[model samples]
Structure formats: C-alpha cells, structure tokens
Target: MTQPPLTTNQDLDSARLREAFGVFPSGVVAVAAIVDGAPIGLAASSFTSVSLEPPLVSFSIAATSKTWPTLRRCDHVGVTILREDHGEVCRQLAGPVDHRFDGLTCSVTGQGALTLDDGVAQFDCTIHEEVQAGDHVIVLLQLHAVAHAEASMPLIFHRSGFGRLSASA
Candidate 1:
C-alpha cells in the first residue's frame, strides 16, 4: 500500500494566501443561533452584505466546524455587528467554546433566536440559503429585523488580530 501525495494549487501557498487576505481589513461580526436554550455564536471577519433591494446578508463558515452544522439547522440566526468595545467579546466568541455566551448580554426574537446587545448593528434573519464555497459554506440569509446603534465605531480584523476603525479614516 502507498500513501497518496498531497496536492494544492501550484501558485498559492496556503499560509501566504491567508496572510495576503489578512491585509485586506474587514469588520468584526458575531454570527449567532440558539439551540436548546443556549446561544451558539462565532466571531467572523468574513461576513459581507450581499444585497439590499429585498434585504440580504451573508457570512461564511468553515465546513469542518461542527458549530456551523448546528447553526445551519437552527430556525433563525442573528448577525451582530460588533462595535469597537467588543474586541474582547470577539476573542471570547472566537475561542474554543463549551460556553460562548457566558454572561454575555443577549435577547431572543419572537422565533427564539438570539440577538446581541450594543452592537453597532444587529440582524435577525432566517437562513435563506447556503452554498459550498471551497472549504467553507456561504450562508445567505433573509433579513427579518434590524437594529442600529449610532455613535458606535466598528470593530475590525486585520492580520489575525482585533482592531477598530480609524476615526480619522
């Protein structure tokens, strides 16, 4: 018996690809879902807004993550726009979690989905669709409710660390 050789795109080193992408600054987000009376959330910098006519949003989740499978099966989910004050919360949610929402301020919708408090913006959504995208799932959502917190600066991500939008930018 012989072991199979590893393969990858010839022009791309995974580490360098990640590093280059890291240079592209992104906003911090908390994608959350409630299961069995507990909230499952993860800090993600890959979130993007897809549309506005009918209102839509999207976020990517690693396909290997068991947490996302649970979230996928959830009836509703929340996308929280983390503010500059949420750097620690971003770290907490991104960490290994037997309990991610420990003592975090949150509330539920009429459908029993979790929502974050004091975020710059919060979105309550129903999973509209999901599609495979390389090693991640691109999750599309139907916007149900939205809230805005003015006077809040955006939390940010760049090169694997937390950041805040430049007030001067």
Candidate 2:
C-alpha cells in the first residue's frame, strides 16, 4: 500500500487551519466563576484532561478573551461539562457578556465558583499553571472536587457545529 503524499507547500491560512481543526470532535465545557458579585463565564471547546497524578484538566482560551481576564482572578473556577441538550445554552454563553447567565439555573460554591445546574459533570478547580501558546493561553487546572452524572451524554462540537454521540457509539 502506498501512502498519500503530504502537501508541503500548503498555505496555513487562519480559515483553512480552523476548518481543519474543526474536523475533530471535542466536548464543550463552561468555565465560570463569580467575579465582582456577578457570574462571569465562557464556553470552551478545547477542554481536555491533562493529568491524573495530580488530578488536572486543561482548557485553552484566546489571549484576547475579556472574560478570562476577570474569571481567572477568582480563587476557584467551576468547569461544567455540558449535556447533549445544551446547544442553546452554549450559544448563550458565547453571546453578550452581560447576558451570559440570563435565565439559566446555576449553583454557586462557597468559594464563588459557579456551575450550571444541568451540566453532565461539574468540577471545582484552581489555576495550577498557564502556558503561553500562539494566540492562546493554555490553562492547567488542579482539581479540588468533581461530580458527574454518568447517564448524561455530553454535548460535542464538531465541524463548527454542536452534536451528540449516537446511542450505538
């Protein structure tokens, strides 16, 4: 069998790179906390588990994110893995900053971390480290506590759209 030749001279334009990156499916998470007596949060499709030894997870946020700048100052952050039915909620999160949590049910931890009530999983975490990547910052979160609804299916972001795994998957 012959392998296909790689395109060495391909132009790595932003649009092309984003389209290529969207080919892979990823789970959506809401990273939020109470900042200045209000709920501040953002939706991230780049959330991933990073380590088990120290119990860590990670998500990448654009360096220009205004929400992250404020949310990161909190002592604790709540990471909520959204359920399959949360497509609209995800959109709202990415919408206007002032209305992000409007009409949504959430729980605030004693330390002010805020998690959506209907999420598939919830994690209480603190910033462990931050790495500067190209146009983004990789945040390493050290887990303090976690809870998950085993029967709930996660919302998936794929091909620049929201979806869910089939029952047969």
Candidate 3:
C-alpha cells in the first residue's frame, strides 16, 4: 500500500503549519498577572508541565504578543487551566486588551498573579526561564502555589476551535 503525497516542506507556511498542528487536541490555559496595578493576560493552548523537582510549568507566547511584555515584568504570573465552560472567557482574553477582564471574575495574589475564579486549576508562578523558538517564546515558570477543582473538565483546543472531552466508557 502507498500513502498519498504529503505537503512539501518547502511550501510550509503559517497557515499550513497551523492547520497541521491543530490536528492534535490541546488543553487551553489563561496566563495572567497584575501589571502596573492592573490585570493583564492572554489565552494559550500550548501549556504543559516541564519539571517536577523544581515544580515547573510552561506555556508558549507568540513573539509578537503585546501583553506578554507587560505580564513578564510582574512579580508573579497566574496560570489558569480553564474549564470547559470558559469558551467565551478565552475569546475575551484574545480580544482587545481593555475588555479582556471586563465582566469576568478573577483573583489576584499579593505577588501580582491573576487567575480566573472558576478555572479547573490555578497556579501561582515566577518566571524560571524563557527559550526563544521559531515564532514563539517558551516560558518556564517555577510554581509557588496551586489549586484545583478535580470535578471540572478542561477547555480544549483542536483544529483552530474550542471543545471539550467526553468521558470514557
């Protein structure tokens, strides 16, 4: 049996790469902080655990991101693993900076981390390191605190859309 021709690497562009990458479903998270006395954040689908010994987590931020510059300067960053019902909240985070947290409920730590009140889980962290990749920066965060709601289902991102997982039989 022979496989069909694959898209050539030479033709790989943003659209093609995004389409190919979107085939795999990933959980979404909200990375936020209180920057200069105000809340600021962005939604990210690239969150993952990085280390156990030092209690580290990671998420990728686009190189062109305007919010990242501000959040990175904060004393701490809040990483919220969004709940399945947070589809609208995720969109708001990606929308205009002024309206991001407009009608949302959130909590801010004394250290400046900000997390959605109803997220599946939340983490308070400080920047550990930042590694620059092709078009994004991989941020490694050192976790200082964590909280969770085990019954909550996480928001998922797949094929450039939001979704949720079904329970197994």
**35-76: candidate 1 lDDT, tens digit per residue:** 887778798888899989778898888888878877777888
TM-score of each: 0.89, 0.96, 0.96
- lDDT comparing candidate 1 with the true structure: 0.84
RMSD versus native structure for model 3: 1.2
Query: Which is the better candidate, 1 or 3, if ranked by TM-score?
Result: 3
Which residue runs of candidate 1 sit more than 4 Å off their true CA positions? 1-10
Residue pairs clashing in model 3 are: none
The lowest-lDDT stretch of 10 consecutive residues in candidate 3 is: 1-10
Model 1: lDDT of residue 2: 83
Candidates ranked by lDDT: 2, 3, 1
Name the weakest run of 10 consecutive residues (lDDT summed) in model 2.
1-10
Provide the overall lDDT of each model, using Cα atoms, as 2-decimal numbers: 0.84, 0.96, 0.93
Comparing 1 with 3 on lDDT, the higher-scoring candidate is 3
Q: Candidate 1 — worst ten consecutive residues by lDDT sum?
A: 3-12
RMSD of each: 6.8, 1.2, 1.2
